[model samples]
Target: EPEVTQTPSHQVTQMGQEVILRCVPISNHLYFYWYRQILGQKVEFLVSFYNNEISEKSEIFDDQFSVERPDGSNFTLKIRSTKLEDSAMYFCASSYRMGGELFFGEGSRLTVL
Candidate 1:
């Protein structure tokens, strides 16, 4: 079965640097999203994109973050400047139908010093 793939399962960086989390969502799926889980917090949605525009976004998605589909199969999340609190597991997900069950990649663990 086709599955989503995330790069660099673990990442470590200083308090104010850029980081790019990558993913390859299942083919044939359209909707894509990015979410994060603080060390002991619940997974929270950052943003959802479809047809090249943002469909939904949580309060957490601010100026420091951006998402892109640079190619047909790759989706990426870029953090312009990371902070200590930005240390978390970033997950990429995609679904064929809106509001349907979302399939998530294993996740990329980002640790900002």
Candidate 2:
């Protein structure tokens, strides 16, 4: 089966720095999302994108966060100013349709100091 893939499996950065997490979702999937798990916490939704625009976003996705489909197959999340609280495993997911079964990437672990 096809899968979503994330880059820099692990990244360490300082607070206030910028971080960009990259993802390549399954070619045929139409919906993409970004979720985060803070160590021991449950996965929390951040944002969802479709048709090259944001479909929805959580409160946690503030001005500091942005999502873009820079190209046909690449989706990305950018944290303009990383915060200590932002340290978490960021997952990239894709689904064929809204509310459909999701396939997640292994995750990119972000460590903010």
On a 0 to 1 TM-score scale, where does candidate 1 land against the true structure? 0.96
Quote each prediction's TM-score: 0.96, 0.96
lDDT against the true structure, per candidate, is 0.94, 0.96
Model 1 agreement with the true structure over 1-113: per-residue lDDT tens digits: 88999998999999889999999999989999999999999999999999977888898999999999988889999999999999999999999987777999999999999
Residue 46 in model 1: lDDT: 98
* Candidate 1 Cα errors over 4 Å, as ranges: none
RMSD of 1: 0.8
Query: Which 10 successive residues of model 1 have the least lDDT summed?
Result: 51-60
Which pairs clash inside model 2? none
Clashing pairs in 1: none
Worst 10 residues of 2 by lDDT: 93-102
Stretches > 4 Å off in candidate 2: none
